[model samples]
Target: MFQYFRDSNNSKNQVSEFILMGFPGIHSWQHWLSLPLALFYLLAISANILILIIIKQEATLHQPMYYFLGILAVVDMGLTTTIIPKILSVLWFRAKTISLPECFAQMYAIHCFLTMESGIFVCMGIDRYVAVCHPLRYSSIITESFVIKATVFMTLRNSLSTMAVPVLAAQRHYCSQNQVQHFLCSNPAVTRLSCDDRKINNIYELVLAWTITGGDLGLIILSYALILHSVLKLNSAEAASKALSTCSSHLILILFFYSVVVVLSITHSASKTIPLIPVLVNVLHSVIPPALNPIVYALKNKELRQSLYKVLKMNIKKT
Candidate 1:
C-alpha cells in the first residue's frame, strides 16, 4: 500500500502510507488485546444505539436532557467507531499499514467527534443548570427549538474547528518516517513524523485543544457551579437532593471522560520513558467511557430503566 513521490528539490521519497504500531513493546501480546477491545467496541456501539432507541420510543423522554443524551449517544458511537475498528484490525490481523488519505480521515473524525462530545457535555450542563436554577423558566429556555439550535451550533463549531487539525497535518511533507506509533492517526502522532517544521502545527493544536476541550469544560464547570448554588438555596433537602441526583449521572460521565483524557495527556508527556502506558490509556479513552455511558445513565435514570424494562418485556413475549 506504500506510494511514494520524489521531492522537487531533493531526490528523497515522500511517504504516502503509514504503519500503525498498535502497542509498542507488546507485539507478542497484541493479539490478546483484541478480544477485550472488540467487546468494548460492541458494547459501546450497542449500548449507545439502545439509548437512542429508548429515547426515541419513550414520549416522556423527549425533553431537553434526554435530547442531549441522544446526541451524546450518537457522538459516543462516532468517537469509538473512528478508531476502534482499525485498532482491532491492527491487533487481530496485523493490517497495520494505512494510506495517507485514510490516516488523515481517521484523524479528523476522531478529533471532530471528541470536540462534539465536549460540546454536548456543555449543552447538558446548561440544560441541568436551567432546570435546577430556574425551574419555571426551564421549559421556555430549553425547548425543542433551543435543542435544535444548540445541536446545530455544536456540530458546526466542532466540525469546522477540528477540520483544521487534519488539514494542517495533510499539508505537511512526510518523508521516510511514516510509522505512526499509535493505533489511530492522532494529530501529534502523525504530525511529528513529518520531515517538516511542525511548530505551527504544534501551536495550532495546543490552541485548538485549549479552545475547544478546555473552553467547553470551563463552561460546564460554571454551569454546575450555578446549579449548585441554586440547589443550596432550595428550602427542602428533598428538592436539593433531587436536583443533585439529576446531575449525578452527568457528573460521572464527565469525570470518566475528562479524567481519562487528562491521564492520556499526562502519559503522552512521559511516553518516552513509559511508552506503553500512553497507548493503553488511549485505547481506554476510546472504549471505556463510551461503553459505560449508557449503562450509567440507564441505571441512574428511573424513567429510562422502566422504559428499557418495558421494551425488554415486550421483546421477550414476542420471542
Candidate 2:
C-alpha cells in the first residue's frame, strides 16, 4: 500500500525515526490526557517501589512468596516504564519522535516484561498450588534457591522468545509513512506500517502469544483445578471456604489481566467500527495492572498489609 512512498535509495532503506501518533482525531485534547496518564505513572512507580522497599526492610517478608511478589513489582515497574514516559512526552510536550533503535528497544522491553509478568503469574499459581495441595512440601518446593532459579529461567526464556519481535520489526523496510497510530510500539501496529509483507511477524506473534500466555493460562487453570479438588476433599465447609478465599485475589488479578488482553485483541480487530476503544484499552492494560497489583496484595495479604503499616508508621515517626 505504501509502495509509492518506499525508499528509493537501496542503500538507505530504513527510516531513522518514527513519529508516534498519540491518539487519532483527538490532537486538540491530547494534552488533557496527560493528567490521568501522569497520575497512573506516579501511582505505578511509587507503589511498586514501596512494595520493594517494604519487602527488603522487613526480614519477615523473606519467604518465597514475597520474593515472587518483589519480582512482580520489578516487572510491573519495567512494564510501566516501557511506555508511560514516552506516552507522557507525547501527551505533555508533543514530542513524538522515536528513533528506530529506541522504538525497537521499547517494543522488546514491553514484550519481555509482559511475558515475564505472565511467567510470574504462572509461578505464583504454582506457589499457591503447592501451598494448598501439598502443604508439607510448600517450603521445600519454593525455596530461596528455587526462586532465584525460577527468576533466571523466566527472564532468559522470555528474553530469548521476545527478541525476535523487535528483530523482525527492525528488519522491515519502513518507507514514507513513519507515523505510528498507537501510543506504544506494538508489534502489529509497527508491522502494519511496513511496505513489505508481515505474514511471518503475524504468525510468529500468534504462536508466541499462544505458547507463552496461552500455556501460562492453561497451567493456571490446571493448578486451580487441583486446588479445587484439594479444597473439596477438606470435608469441612469452613476449610473449603478458606482455601477458596486464598485463591480469590490471584484469580481477580488473573481475570483483570486476561480480560483486558482479550478485549484489546477484539477491539483491535474491530477497531474500524469502534476506533477509540482499542487505544484506551491499550493504555489501560499497561497501566492498570501495575497500579492495582500492589494495592491488591496490600489489601488482601495480611503480612504485606502489616508491613506496609509498619513502613507508614516509621515514615510518620520521622516527621
Candidate 3:
C-alpha cells in the first residue's frame, strides 16, 4: 500500500540515520548483557552450522526431516545474523544508529528468514504427518523431486513476500520521524518512522502477517491435526508411542514459534494503546525464541544430540 516518495529528480532522498532504543538496563548490566547475547549468537551460529554439516556428511540424515532441519538452520542463521550483530553493537559500543538502506536491508532479511522458517516448519509438519500416517508411502510421498520443487516454491514465495513491506514503506515520506523504538528495522517499527500516509504500509503489514505468518501457522496446525488423526488409527501401542514421540517435539516447537509471532503481532498492534507491554513482548519475540530453538531441538532429538557431540569433537580436535 505504501509507495516510495521519490524526489522529482528521481534521486535518492537522502535520510542519513536512525536511532535505536535498546533494552532498559543498568549501564553495567547492559555490558553484562552483551556478553550473554554475544555468547548466545555464537552458540546459535555454531549449532546451526553443525547441524548443516552433519546433515551434509551423514548419509543417514539425507531424509526429509533433516532436509527441513537444514532449511531451518539456514533460516535461523539469517534471522539471527540480521538482528543480533547490530544489537551487540548497540550494547557493546553504544552505537545505536542505522542508515536507511541498512534499515531496509535488515527488515527484508528478518522478514525473509521469518517467512522461510514458517514455511519450512509447515513442510516439516507435512513430512512428519506422512511418515506417521502412511509410513508405507512416506518415501514416495516426500521424494527428491518433491523436496526440490517444494524448496523452490518456498524460497521464491518467502524471498518475494516481504518485499511488499519496503515497497509500501517507500511510498511514504520519511522526513518527519526517524526514531525506532527498538533495535533493528521491523516492518511496523520502520513504518512508524515514516511521515507520509502510513495506511498502505500498515495494511501491507497486517496482510503480510495474515498471509505469511497466519497462513503458515494454519498449514502447520492442519498438518499436525492430520498426523494426530493418523496416529490414533494405529492399532499397536508401540507404533502409537513412536508416532507420538516423533510429533511431540515438533508440536512443542510449532506451539512456541507460532505463539511468539502471534503475540508479537497482537502486542505490536496494541502498542498504540499499551506501550510498555508490547515492547517487552517484541524483545521476547526477537531474542528468547531464537536463543532457545536450537537448544530445545538438539536436546530432544537423538540424531541432533549425537551430531552435536560429533561437531564438538571435530572442533576440539581442530583446535
List runs of model 2 lying over 4 Å from the truth: 1-14
Query: Mind giving the per-residue lDDT tens digits that candidate 1 earns over 1-319?
Result: 1121113212332775899987888877788988999999999999999999889888989898999999999889989988898888887778999977778778888898888888999999999999888889999999999999999998999888887777777778787798888888888788888888988887988898788999998999999999988888889999899999999999999988888878888888798789889888987888888899999999998888999998888889999
How much does candidate 3 score in TM-score? 0.89
Candidate number with the higher lDDT (1 or 3): 1
TM-score of each: 0.94, 0.94, 0.89
Name the best candidate (by TM-score). 1
Q: Residue 47 lDDT in model 1?
A: 96
For residues 1-319, could you state the per-residue lDDT of candidate 3 as single tens digits? 2123233113434456678776433334555667767887888888778778888877777888888888788788878888888988887788888866667767777788888888888888888888888889999899877788888999999888888776666555667566777766777777787666688778877888898888888888888888878888889989889888887667777888888877777778787776556655665555556666667777888876787788678889999
**Model 2, range 105-156, lDDT digits (tens) per residue?**
8888899999999999999899899988998998888899989999999999
Q: Rank by TM-score, descending?
A: 1, 2, 3
Clashing pairs in 3: 2-168, 3-170, 3-171, 4-170, 4-171
